[model samples]
Target: MIHLKNVHKRFQKPEGGWFDAVRDTSLHVRAGEIFGLIGFSGAGKSTLLRLINLLERPDSGSVTVDGQPLTALSASALRRARQNIGMVFQQFNLMANRTVAANIAFPLEIAGWQQADIDARVAECLDIVGLADRAQHYPAQLSGGQKQRVGIARALAPRPHVILADEPTSALDPKTTQSILDCLQDINARFGVTVVIVTHEMHVIRSICHRAALLDAGEVVEILSVQDKQVSAQSALAKSLLEVA
Candidate 1:
């Protein structure tokens, strides 16, 4: 469903230096696979995800989704194409001004759905996330997991073709993290949406992803299958996390 070729992203530092956030990262995520991009804080995991969505354009190389060349699209065209991609942030970027239902309805509203259609989608999404009863609650009143669930609901409301999750469960406790992961797994199993998870949490990747890539120093060092069900004696990703010591 997604492909990247020789993708490079460099940022100009205030100190008159260039920082290579991503360096020639190329990988393919097949349709219906939960692909994990594991990396440390500066390993360019998030940069790679943003590159896929064109939020941060690549300095050189290409990002293609379902055969559409995202790098070559015009701004307006990219905007339209982006509608098919849904993203959830680490902070659960909900509109503080909107209620749970309103926040879930936001994406549908952006897509120009009718009020009735938006309401229907919101109801369906709330039910899927088991948050139908809390539809009136606000972010301030919800737990971290609940807020993230609302984020997932909002992302799904648009019926996106692909879901890009960045550190989705970082703030939640272990039990809550499992809950969110279960929800994600269910979404992928039921909807067949391609999931790209960029996270530092190995547990999250192992629990849900079908395949994974380990990133270190702005490069993809290794790719593995979660289905392998065997511990890596010398996992590059685990070593980056100091888990293999």
Candidate 2:
């Protein structure tokens, strides 16, 4: 449901030179599939994710989501379309001043839902993320994982069709990361939402992604499916398993 056609992103360096953060990257994310983007730092993974969300517009080429040209839309129209896409970050990015319930209700409020509707949605979302008991708690009162749960609830508040996750599990410990990964998998399977996860952790990709692309220095070097036999992803996974044991 997402397409990037020959997209290129560049930045003006302090010395008056341009650095290409993303170069000629093109990929598609199908409906109901969890797509993973893997790379070392400086591989443009974050830049690529931001392109999909229009947080950074492409300097060249286009980004289209579910047949609408994102590059062609007005700011207001883009804002409306963005409601159909949700994003979670490594930092959780929760408002420390807001309670969990208020945080989850923020998107609904922006969407202009009725007060009763917002209340019901907030309750439902709090339950979905297993934070119903902490509805009145602020970010400072929650653990890292709990804060992230609130972030997830807020992202899902609009019932978006697509979810973009950027290193979502990086901030948590392994045990907490596993828990969060399981929760994300549940969200994907239960709702049929198309998920795009950008991470450096192969274990995270293996646990949740149906397919993945390996990016190297702004180039997508390989796209592999977990279900496909004799693929590099499978081999790499096998190697990792062998090493772990």
Candidate 3:
């Protein structure tokens, strides 16, 4: 469960003036549902995702996740709250030197988990991402898909209540992307983790999202529902995106 109300974020331009990255946007994501934020580059989908976790603190607005008002939280409180929210990046942001298991265990370690518990959680996450056999492998040794799986495993190692994936499949080939999507779908179905993904690919939304928000120039254009792999497009931008799919 996530909600953003009257959210606005602005960045100072290099020369002068400010640029609005998110403009008075409001959205709600229900528990255990896969939601999508789709838009072209500069649409601020990624910024919105980061805002949900306060990675980019909004200039004005409120962000609530799992009933916690993230915007009002103290730094320590926010740190504790973030443990329940996981993020998967477009580029697999793995530790180049750490083995798969170590990478997955990093967050747990930071959370002060006992060594035994961290070990168990890492193993379980590795299995969930189908990377059990590669637990000892380094990021450089894996294929693109394997690397992303490692990223996913790391995200799941925290037993997070929500997962924010920013273009998780964009870096992989189509077949590999499908595999990653399947893994995410399985995670949502089996674990009931609320997932919010940011992607430009329509097929990514249609394949896994229950609902999606189309964004343009840092604002929400429309929210569309997906049923049986069909996206109900109500706006011109939504229809155009669907047509391209």
Candidate 4:
């Protein structure tokens, strides 16, 4: 449901040079599967995720999501298309001042939903994230896991076709990570939203990903299926990660 072909992206370094964030990277994410981009810091995993939603446009290649060429869309069309592509971030990115319900309602409000519809969607999303009783809670009052759950609820409130999660469990403890992973897995099975997760942790990939691309230095080295081996991702870095663990 998503494709990136020969994509390249770079940024100006603060030291007066160009740094390539993504280098001729190509990847495909099948529908209704959790695809993980596994790599270390500076490996461009996050940049790759942004390309799928056109948050970071490629310098040279094509980005297609759900059969639409994201790079070819006009600004207005892209805005409309983005509603079908929800994103969950590592930092939670919640407005400290807004309650969980209000935070989840922000996207629906932006999409011009009626107040009644927004209220229904927000409550439904809170229930999905198992935070129905926390609707009135603010970010400052919640735990790290709770904050991330709120982020997930906000992403789901739009009922997007695809969900791009960037290191969704990086901030939490091991137990909390498992809970979030389970939530993601449940969401995938129940909603059939194509999930693409970016993370440096091999445990994250092995835990929930059906298919994964091993990335290094902004290039994908190998693609592995969890159902086939049920272990490591089978790349050199992946082996190293297993060894370290």
Q: Write the per-residue lDDT of candidate 4 for residues 157-212, one digit (tens) a residue.
A: 88998999999999999999999999999999999999999988878878889988
Each model's total of backbone clashes: 0, 0, 0, 0
Clashes of 3: 0
Q: What would the TM-score be for candidate 2 when compared with the true structure?
A: 0.93
CA RMSD for every model?
Answer: 1.8, 2.7, 0.7, 1.3
TM-score of 3: 0.99
Model 2 per-residue lDDT tens digits across residues 43-112: 8998999999899999998999977899999999999999889999999998888998999998888888
Best by lDDT: 3
C-alpha lDDT (0 to 100) for residue 14 of candidate 2 = 98
- Name the regions of candidate 4 deviating beyond 4 angstroms: 232-234
Return the lDDT, model 4, position 75: 99
Candidate 1, poorest ten consecutive residues by summed lDDT: 228-237
TM-score of each: 0.94, 0.93, 0.99, 0.96
Scored against the true structure, residue 113 in model 4 reaches a CA lDDT of: 99
Each candidate's lDDT (Cα)?
0.89, 0.87, 0.95, 0.90
Report the lDDT of model 4 for residue 200: 85
True-vs-predicted CA distance for residue 43, candidate 4, Å: 1.0
| Model 4 steric clash pairs | none
- The residue ranges of model 1 lying beyond 4 angstroms of the native Cα positions read 228-245
- The 10 consecutive residues of candidate 3 with the worst lDDT sum are 236-245
